[model samples]
Target: MINSSAFQGKKAAYFTLGCKLNFSETSTIGRLLGEMGVVTAAKGEPADICIINTCSVTDMADHKCRQAIHRMVRENKGAFVVVTGCYAQLEPETISRMEGVDLVLGANEKARLIQYLSEAWTDKTDEENGLHRHFSVATKDIKDFAPSCSRGNRTRYFLKVQDGCNYFCTYCTIPYARGFSRNPTIDSLVRQAEQAVAEGGKEIVLTGVNIGDFGVSTGETFVELVKELDKVGGVKRYRISSIEPNLLTDELIDYCASSRAFMPHFHIPLQSGSDAVLKLMHRRYDTALFAHKIRLIKEKMPDAFIGVDVMVGTRGELPEYFEETYRFLESLDVAHLHVFPYSERPGTAALKIPYIVSDREKKLRSKRLLSLSEEKTEAFYARHIGTTAEVLLEKAARGKAMHGFTRNYIRVELPSSQADEALDNQIVTVRLGDFNSDRSALKITL
Candidate 1:
């Protein structure tokens, strides 16, 4: 088989389906193909090949995947479509059967794509014809690790130190989709982290489905990873994207409180405040534990930004239970909320359980929680008013001002500047001003 190097002038298009991790992976895929001299092209024009990095956090993801494939076929009939990632890993047969799918590489087999596709392309002329290839594992525990994706445009980078999950919660398909937990060695992780910092990233966000589970592989733990990243060069701040309250330790919290690099921000998932509902969801932690974790953070860093991940609709969660959840959150000092109206996925215990929350009810509950989030967030931000906070100025957002984040993760928009200092990871002291009408962020003055 000829190397993809033979297709020096050929084009490839990357379509990423999900979170920041997926985006990072897609960018890396493009980068590798670019190094092989196969460059990515803008959409609409027919590319010789296409890579669709898929996701399957929900059933809607499958629908979107199919929709994207159909659109690709319509746009460029002869383009080769290589499907990989979570959805591809779980339902290789389903994706393989899709029209125009030439290659289907599962989560574990994705890295083999360059080799497989290169061989296929060299021997074939019809790029749109689906290839006879599928790679999937029945048991996640024994699956191999395959890393894709790379860092991004910000002074901040997302290093996927871990992959897959061992927690087979009743409502989750992630363990089946992503396979067992596997991560890079501490030395490898530090190499990538340092590389990101060297590449001009001023901050790095530790990203994963379960970052708290990061260092269970090595003798080192997630807490130790934080300490190591603190010592790395050029990185000013480190943020955890989302962590389980149960896995979040006091030692880690204390480290963040004292560390110069770790940011004072915590995003903990609290599926339910009702013990009965929490039990049904199979979450490891209860309201008491979650609340205690929050208390610990606030006790250590009063100005910390606390974000809660709440699922509005789930089985066994009665209206009273929702009120319990709301009241529990209200009792805390959380600054924001990420509300997900529980969407049922097939093959999950939650789907079979009776009395699922109606879409309307889910919407209502989501709205109610969001309102509380507004009040809590505004109150938290209001506490910092009339004082100056050190902010990392990001590239401008919208029209008029430069945008960045405060130490506590409060996004602030400052008056735009071309002093060359306000670009990228420039740290500047900005005075707090009035709230932006959006209520999503703050407008500040430099």
Candidate 2:
């Protein structure tokens, strides 16, 4: 209901944090505003409106969101500022009171932000509703799927095929913030991907909070979705963002190995290798099942890249438990680890659990896991040296070189002189050479 004239000559800038899902949603919002006649604020330029999409995965994410909001207000004086996404959904009142924040929308209300901007924005007064506005429909009301895709990048697009999570893990607030798991029909998603390819996207990453649990409402499966997506004509590649260990079936792994466009890369969350910690965290799978999943992927696609999400210093994770996780990871063939140190959230089940991990211990464990990740990544890269792989080169130039990722997800960087503008967004077979120490990017020979 916003007057179209209001956005006719205005510019808006967006800042996204957290997952690819957030990026996709932000892009969708930008596209919607563009249709309403608002242009994007160019890089390093100020805009009349600034939208900040936030994440609240941890306490640190909340701190970062506050810092970003404050910085945006200071830099873009008098601009109408909007904050939305997970953090806003969890703490809408707090975000609303922040100086210069014009609107605070939650997960359910965010998609309808344009309408609110039209109706509530101009009517609000300092005496009536204080400085900022807030709206958060209950999480239960956020049932419908909001399809979003990132199209700004020509080489790759992150298509949000699914949203929300049903699994209420002990230490996680994603389920509370995002609501239950849901996704669109396969026909709808296929059409979305086709449109993305028609717009010049070469690859799409299927993203969600819990994609492996796809199709609770539609009676479809993640495997079935991928099979249909594989038949899509224009797109050359698709990558599964991440899947739960218990849900990553052997059938899916086998299919990816022989599929036409699916990449041989898997990011499975194995929050802890210790059985005790896994139980305490309410994870669906144990270390045995996780290891079996890894074995299957490696057996089918030996050169496949596997990433692990591991958390350190969760409640009840004693010294013995920490050692167990570290040793198990060391024994596995995981390419890298996304190591997170646990931080207690207010309403999570972890709050009820005894044996809180000291901050000092958490930092030490996080550091140890990160160091282990470096070793695993280096070894994974070393194993692929002297092999040839198909790489989808990205558009951006980092320093004097351009970077790309192989089908197995090994990052490769080539000199800009060697990679012409025509090479951008094109798939090229390149010989993987030695790892470059200076750049930390794998060298590729044309």
Candidate 3:
């Protein structure tokens, strides 16, 4: 057993690799550790304990997680390693068996990490064994919603109001990793938002596995949650991370268009634009319905930023089907695209389907969609070249320039002469200028 004093005054370093929701959870964990007298390790400082929050979205993601774990063990030798999150829940035994992992925490157990650590640190038998082998994972149908908010970054907070997913897309494992849809009461989320504001946050991005499925247990809708969050004072802006196409209602679009707090930005996932591929993937909305949703958002708020998620080379996606998807996306008025090459996951229904696209074809298709994304992004930026919008400045600076994002999600870079470090979290009006040479960002006319 580690003598209780062995942990005294030791720093802990947290490494998180995944979505916005994971970041929110990690920040919350950091706060909890702070309250326990365990401070976060400063940059380049090795700590006595290291916690890794992992992701398992794709095969590459899994490989990255494994590589991080092995690298951490090699660099921070003898440091107590704790692994948690979706990957841990999926493969607890495998993680615990790794060279230096002292503890492994699953989904429900992750939030209570402090308590687990307290218990393990005091238990002599756990230390004698050199590993904590046995662990409990919350059932696959978790109902409890643990709200999280990121801090330390004053410009934006990723507020996780919802958790889990009910839509089990054939190619996805999130339903098994995250569990059924659930959320806390609206009152709880509003309080969390208020707390974020109290901590000096200027913007809050609502995130979840399936946020549109929120309020299933509380009889509250996503729209209702948005309305309540808007009532909270001090937070100048809020953005929804991503929502399924079918779940993004017309009312939400209209409300955001006229909202005083909600930003004019929407990230909607249209995984595949080909109706045939979408049907095979078990997506609820078809191409027609997805198109109509985009049309409505554009019609109501023409200048609103609309970002889409597109996955290429899924199982059975023929060349013609890919072309169909390409044509569909090209016809849409989206501002940006997140292109992904589909990776088959173990135990997913996608593995059973025949006609799996080859790696060469997957890479080729991904390249095409990425090029299309660039063109669409340039067109979107060009549409607002001369317009003025409020930009929330960020801290990063390149030599004498600072960067920020407009309300509609256009990134702008300007000379530090016009933006001082003191204006990091403040929103300022700046006329949009020409796109950068690469078309990735815009120049601000201050």
Candidate 4:
């Protein structure tokens, strides 16, 4: 266990769940905690506090959250355990009742966690993990959801210009866990983007629970944010992480296609290809419409990288449904796939349904889709052989040189130029080469 006095200087441990957005927010929070002179302790040893950034996408997420707290207590019996994130935002009371959880912070309260802890911290009651004022957004107003994002790697930062969602899809818990769609003014967002660039961020991913809704100004929309972000200097690329098919507007697609800073990459979620399954899942877009969007993106930029999110094993998905999804993806010109098996979430309409996919069946379906993803990815990589692509050199590799991603999203490792820290953010053109002759990151010719 971490010696109690070791934390007199302030030591912390962090864990996160859910999407890239969660990771981004956790990093932001960790950075804020660092400003107060707290250093992160390795897990298992003891620490001043164990701050858990959680998720509520599924019941499994909540189970893991609860399990983690118990495990933390087992390892460091008297450590202060704090819980926050979407799960806390939805069920602070639930967390408050847990044996090991001392502080349960919701969406808003989590932002000032360190300040709160500093005010109430006491070595005398580490085991008396009490609950905090629940700022859980479960029943709160929608537009009230606060905006936050993450600086995953120094080169790529996720700038959350918006938060919350308006859609009440039957199988989704986001509206309840998060709230309604809320966004920041373009001017405010532009200022933040400028600061991120000035802080050495080479790329900014415009993220949000719902980014398509970014706009507070009259008739303002995400396009305006993209157009303005494209106009910003310093960053070599700006990638739109993901968007709903209906929201990936002609205007937005065209902007990305033409913008010098925007890369030709798009990831759209198509939960299922069968209309029957989609209807049951409450997805707004259908297979036909989803396919059309893919076609349009390919027409504009043949080499543009396209990724699709497919969820298998939903309630209404029959054996035929899996075939339908596979055929749909096979027909697309996408470069890769992110396959997820549908999991039940408490309070979500999905859990009340009678038709359920077995875990074994779900695993089989997931594996089938993932195998196809590898083939599609390999096919995409094969086309790039011998073609020169632009790569942003990040930090070191397994042992030797630096590594980075091409504008199209291919991972490549290049020999170290160790050129000043300037090489950290500057985009370098490299010819695509084969994997290390032995076995390692795919090599590139500078």
User: On residues 1-446, what C-alpha lDDT tens digit does candidate 2 reach at each position?
Assistant: 47877778788888888988898899888888888899988887788788899999999999999999998888877677899999999999999999888889898888787887766545544334234888887778878667787765446888888889989999999988898898888899999999988888889999999999889869999999999999997889999999998889888988999999999999999999999999999999899999999988998999899999999989999999999999999999889899999988879999888988899999999999999999989988988899898999877653467889998889999876786777889999999999886736689989
Each candidate's TM vs. the true structure?
Answer: 0.92, 0.96, 0.95, 0.89
lDDT of 4: 0.76
- For candidate 4, the 10 contiguous residues with the lowest summed lDDT are 1-10
The root-mean-square deviation over C-alpha atoms between each candidate and the true structure, in angstroms, is 2.4, 1.8, 2.4, 3.9
Winning candidate number (TM-score):
2
**lDDT per residue as tens, model 1, 1-446:** 54755879888877879777777777777777888888777656788888888888776777898788777766766777888878887889987887778888877677566777777775456443667467766753435655532653445577777777877776778777777777777778778777876677777777776878986667668988888878886788888888899899999999999997899998898877788888888889888899899999999998999999888788778999999998898898899988877777778878767877888998899999989988988998888777788888776454556678999988886655433443557888888877777766677776
**Model 4 compared with the native: what TM-score?**
0.89
Output the better candidate (1/2) by lDDT. 2
Model 1 RMSD vs true structure: 2.4
Clashing pairs in 4: 1-46, 2-46, 24-150, 102-129, 142-180
Question: Which 10 consecutive residues of model 3 have the lowest summed lDDT?
Answer: 121-130
Q: Would you list the rank order by lDDT, best first?
A: 2, 3, 1, 4
- What is residue 23's positional error in candidate 2, in angstroms? 1.0
Q: Report the number of clashing residue pairs per model.
A: 3, 0, 0, 5
lDDT of every model, 2 decimals = 0.79, 0.88, 0.84, 0.76
Residue-level lDDT tens digits of model 4 in 174-284:
777666677778777778778887887878887777777666423588888788878778767888888989889988887788887999888888888888888888878
Candidate 2: TM-score? 0.96
